[model samples]
Target: ISLLQDEHELARIVADMPWSKIDVNGLREQETRIRRQIERIENDPELGQLQTELKQLNQQATAENRNQYQAEDDLDKAQHAVQAEQAWLDAYGNDDFDDATLSSMVSNLLADAYENCFGASVRAQDRPKLIAGLFDHESETPFHTRALRNIVRIARTRIQEIDARSNQLRADTERIMDDYLNNHSTDDNTVMASVEDYRYFLDELDELNMLVTRAATDEEYANSVKKLYMSFQQLNRALRTDEENIKEQLNRINSMLKGQQFGPQGGRLSLDVTFSPIDRQFETTLSRILSKLEDWTRNASDNPTETRNAFNNCETFVNRLHNELDKIHDTNGIKAYGARNLDPRVRSSFYAIVHHDNAPDERISSTGGKSGGALQELTSFVYGAALIYLLGGDLTARPTYTTLFLDEALIKADGRYTKRALAVLPRLGFQIIVSAPESKTAEILNVANRAYVAYKDPSTDNSYLQELDSETITQDETQPTTAPAKPTTEA
Candidate 1:
């Protein structure tokens, strides 16, 4: 009864447990199977090998974790170092700092520091040492400070040389200024010496330079004036030569007309040439200018006062010429002097003067009030004379043979006037060839050396020339001479 009570208590405890609902048999079986697996693992050879490999892999993992930690620490340290260097560079770098500029700044700073550190004992060899000491913590290599020392020394030497040269120049400038003041001391031009300051000395030097330049310019102007004066002299000589030639030509023409008599009253003809009143004035002024220019050139180098006076006179004449030219409306004015105004035909008035025994002297201009017959006779004389002048070998001697063509000449003249006209050209040394109609043929044949009659053939339309006998047209011997009536003048 005691054992039964114990069993009954146990059953009651089992029922009151939390896992009392579980199958106790199934749990026992799963535990048995897990036990069997654990036993197999303990006894297998490949399992022991896997365990050994796992042990080694864990050891390797531990070592790899330690190496990774070390690597991360090293990377952090390296990054900090790069950042420190970048920050340092940023402290000194600037946008304006190119390589040359930055190098100069660094050199100056190092030189100053070197000078402060060692003072007079700053040797070239010690420069690199100083550079290294200053920038030892920097990543870049130090500068070659020996070259810097040499540059500084050379710069200082050059500065001293410049100062010495400047002093010499100042002394030379003072000496030259004193010399100039002493030499150029004149009553009209007084040079003051105030060279105490360098700038004042430079100012005085500049003034002297300007004066020298002005003197040179004055010399050049004088040379130009000389050239202009020489040109005027040449022009004057040419004008004189042309005038002489014209006078000679007129003389020749007049000599040819001296003995030749024309018209019923036995009148003589002569040509006259003269410049207009304004042209004469311009010529006179030009002569005066030439004289003044001569005086100026003669005194230009030696006498300043005389040169100035002569130049002023020339200027006055030139101004007068300019004013006159401005007033002239005609292009044929004195401005055209050498070309057109000087031409005898353009500027001068021509008159055919007839001098007779009883009549007053009559001037026949271009618009003459004279009979055509009388004018034609006079024109023949003048034309003959001009031809003789143009045939320019020897004025006194006649040519061997020179032909003068008179086409229908003396057609308007009477028989006496025609005979006189025809006789004049032959006397002036011309072979006369006359072309006159049958009406005047008798008078023309009296003077013509040879004659030919031209006729055209109507059938063939061709022209033919035939010589005619001089005896065909004969002068009448019985024609009585009578005193010519007074030649009527045209209204």
Candidate 2:
């Protein structure tokens, strides 16, 4: 038991832990994307086709790269010559170089060029002199020096054009590859039926691969991996927090189940009240009797029949009073009295325990009301059933017998009213056993499991009990036999 309790406590502690929030939607979307990717690869041929195209493009790009390299080499060589001439020009203004050294540099600059270099650089008039000087290894002509600078400028411009062309070609190819790969990775394509139609998919795959390569080089892929790892950590933190909250809630619920004491109050009791038409009628009748009682008291009648009627009326009222009080005792009335710290035994006597502290001019008041009888009984039964539910006794340990004994109850009730009142008993888990005169026997027999009729034997001069069978009762009820004066036992 100790081990179990410790484990439970540990679980609660774990559950109570504060955790982090997770991007559940993001995780779901990622899962869906992966699933779709797998499905596309297994069922579609787009990726493979893109790979083939990418392979072909790779070969073509390789050749193009070689050409670009050559062009770059040429551009480098041209730029070097321009730099050499510019350097010489700048230095010429600062320090004078000998003609032989200048002539040697110019010869070296124009060594690989055609005659166009000399023709373009020097003027037509100075061209012959510059050429003769160069042949004789002379640097006397200033026109030759100017012509050499012009040739260098021309070479630089030509190299720039070559470089631009090479760059443009490379840019176009890279753009095509990037577009293809991006479309494949980011754009959703419909699955095609034909393998031939899968070429578009291959184009996308190629673009995607290229994109991957770029991301890999830039550490973008690593960033994504780190982001995913952090997301998982957050999810775990959230899980821990949620578990702790759940455990705390469970503990609270368990405490409630164990019945927590709130305030100095001990416990609460439930009550159910069911009012009936008979109870209403009784209330009206009692009101009428009270109204007439004052007039009767003022001038008492000498007539015996009137006196008998009064006594019978009083007897009827008293009988109803007993039933009402019994109803209160059986139902929530006792519980209500207990709640108010009133004595149930003392309160059960009168229709309602009245307080007479006020003067005659003041209105009379009572602690309770006259709404009793079947109404109170029904109410109490309902309250009892509700109490059972509130206590969860029905779920834990059901009562063996939910029975109520009402002696001489509802005697004035009609067959319809009686059955209706009885109908609710079973639903409320009540088996009401009512002792009533045989006039109400038919109604009882209709609903009762078994009934007994008591009769005094004339020959033996002894009282005997006989178990009345259901079939005999049914037959006798149809014929409308007079009810016996004595009340019958019902179960």
Candidate 3:
């Protein structure tokens, strides 16, 4: 019984990793793949449905062999699950359970767990520590009433510590190597100093790992490992925060760009930006500016003529700054955005115009509503284009940005226009990071060397943005949205 209990617990633990990472899609995909791989029994396939059934039966037979030993630990946990399920089922069915029936049900469930989980399933016998897993039993032994739980735990605990140490050693090696490469210089002394520093950090990490692995007991190892884990958390936080000010600076520049006054009531291509974070939902103020610009472009008669000149002059300076900043960073990641410049669509064609037409807004005009929706589209386009144009161009460049992001970029465009607009991106230039979600196409994934998915946690008012890789990259920041006041009455 104790041995069977141990097997149940092991089986339960074995399932932990795959479950945490695999969601519905992954599971469904795996199931489908298995289904395809298994040929019908009628086909005389090498690995068919019959083969699967055979393996399952083999497992059942082995489990039955262990049943005579009465592995109590596994049986207990299995009994617990079975009892819980039975209680629910009985209640639903308006039935009552007797002791014999209950015991039989528990035993049957235990047998199933033994068969399915390779007889290593955790069971109710491990409830001693309440390990949170389904098969965790309260006591160690169920096979024949020996205190086997402690003995196995002691062994597992030691093994876990050693595993941690080995992983830490690998991390140290990578960190040391990355540091050595990053700090490598043309000067011999500088290179040697960097190499020495890298080596020192590696030695420090290795020593700590060794200490953890060599600790006298699992408890000692756990305590020591907590300190190491905390240290790692600190390092990861530091790395994430290090030199992130560049994005903030860019945001500020964007704010200034947003502040640039386009045409007033009646102008050609007026652009007043409403600056918001990449995750911000809408730029209300910017929307109004876009509305006004659109109106002016479309209603030139209503706009102030002087307003058009001021807007033009402001844009000239804005374009120059944008170009200069573009020089500082490689916007290769969003190359697709700017790819097909002379596209037939008005939006794409006009956006291409912004790329080369850096003149002040006075020369550009929407007199008598001739400018059309060009003003609004160009406003979003320039910012979007600037982002696309500035992403690190060399997909292979180390230390380059791993992601590119923009929020609510396609605010007002219709489906056809948006589709046409997005098509231009792949042709633009480079793709180093993975930030933007292109329309309906995972095809982009094929070309991307890497991709990132970012989102805020839903549990709190304070937005905690987390990346898919389990790293907290930024603070709890709210996505910017269009202020309620801005109205785009396009009647």
Candidate 4:
């Protein structure tokens, strides 16, 4: 059992051994065969030659191993060079160089470098030689890299200078803007800094400059003065003519009023027009300018001293006239300066004067002291005379029938005054139509040849008119005695 136990341990140890399954008899037979072959080779006569050949073959195998290693290393270096060249091409090559030749690629690179360094493109022929010189150590201009560095340095210096100048300009602009805003600040602390405000200021400056230039010479100033003087003369003549026309019309109206008889005393009426200057200073200056202009015209060529004095006087008067005009706030005053007489500066007052054969002359303007009937009679004569003045044309010619319509007129007048007032219009060739209330119907009809009654329908809220014969009316009848069934015409 002990031997069997040891034998089992040995079998287990053999199973664990690395080479426990070796064929020992085959190994011994291979060792005997190898020694027998070696002995036979050493003893044979061709052994030396065979040994020499074997040694030579071993040397050849060693050389071939060394050559294989060198070739592998060279191939790795070539691969690395190819990868590096491909990366360089990716960095610098353009799509334009996709099918280009190697010479073209080198020329393009040189051209790009030259343009970048010198800020200009080189010719194609110059590119190759420049590229060759960049890489050639023997060339005099081999400092292309230094030149590029210098260009970069110059660009940086210029950029810094531009930045400094820009900052200075910005500071100056801000300072100027602040100063302008401060100077032009308004009462509300607002600045008129808009482009339009600046433009308007510039325009005003230009106009002032133009005026200054225009009057810089004495001859130019004289010419301007002459123009202004002539304008003033023309305007004065126009205004005087307008004033004469107005006076003539007033005279014609006065003539018509003189023929009319008013009240029981047969009073005559007249309109009085008075002239007064709106601006006394402006008129005085204008008159002085006119006198100076006349003097200048009369003695300008004859006497130099008189011409100069006249011109100076005219200029002074013109300046005063301009100042006075500036002070004038009336629209008519300004229009008069432009020769447009919308409102004549002369103020006119109309007065109805009564010329009675028995009593002293009285002015109708004092209506506060007069009776309402007397005032009404006087106004009616004045109005009838004004109508005749407008429509009578020539007073000497025979009159034509012109209709005058009066609504509720002469109601405050007594019967005698109302009759006289109503007769005044018909005598002036006016056919009068009087519309009065029922209370004044008797007074109105005393002189009316025809009358009309206005009636309103309560249901329809419409008004209508009915004509009446004057013979049918009586002093006792206030309302219409009869009205037509339907309206003669709508009112």
What local distance difference test score does each model get? 0.68, 0.53, 0.43, 0.67
Tens digit per residue, CA lDDT, model 3, 300-344: 523345344324433543343355345443366643332111111
lDDT of 4 at 265: 76
- Comparing 1 with 4 on TM-score, the higher-scoring candidate is 4
Per TM-score, what order, best first? 4, 1, 2, 3
> Positional deviation of 125 in candidate 1, in angstroms?
99
Instruction: Please give the ranking of all candidate structures by lDDT, highest first, separated by commas.
Output: 1, 4, 2, 3
Per-residue CA lDDT of candidate 1, range 1-491, in tens? 99999999989988788885778899799999999999998999999999999999999999999999999997985666566556545754454534565567556755565465444766766544444444345574434355456556756765788899988987788788778867876765444454456576576786677667835445445655676677667756765566557667788889888878867777787876665443666678788788777666565556656555555566765665457455435564534433343344344566767788788987777745766677777778888898787784667766678987777766787777788888888888888877777677677667666777776655566766667673532322333466443222110
Candidate 1 Cα lDDT to native: 0.68
In order of listing, the candidates' clash counts read 0, 15, 60, 0
- The runs of at least 3 residues in candidate 1 whose Cα sits more than 4 Å from the true structure, single-residue gaps closed, are 1-219, 233-245, 274-295, 298-347, 358-360, 470-491
Best by lDDT: 1
Single out the weakest 10-residue window by summed lDDT for candidate 3: 344-353
The runs of at least 3 residues in candidate 2 whose Cα sits more than 4 Å from the true structure, single-residue gaps closed, are 1-377, 383-397, 458-461, 474-491
Cα lDDT of model 4 by residue, 327-445, tens digit: 54657555433222223533655566668888999766667877777777777777777777667677764247788778777667778777887888788777877877777877777
TM-score of each model, paired residue for residue? 0.43, 0.23, 0.17, 0.44
Could you report the Cα RMSD, in angstroms, for every candidate shown?
31.3, 51.3, 40.6, 28.7
Candidate 4: worst-modelled 10 consecutive residues by lDDT: 337-346
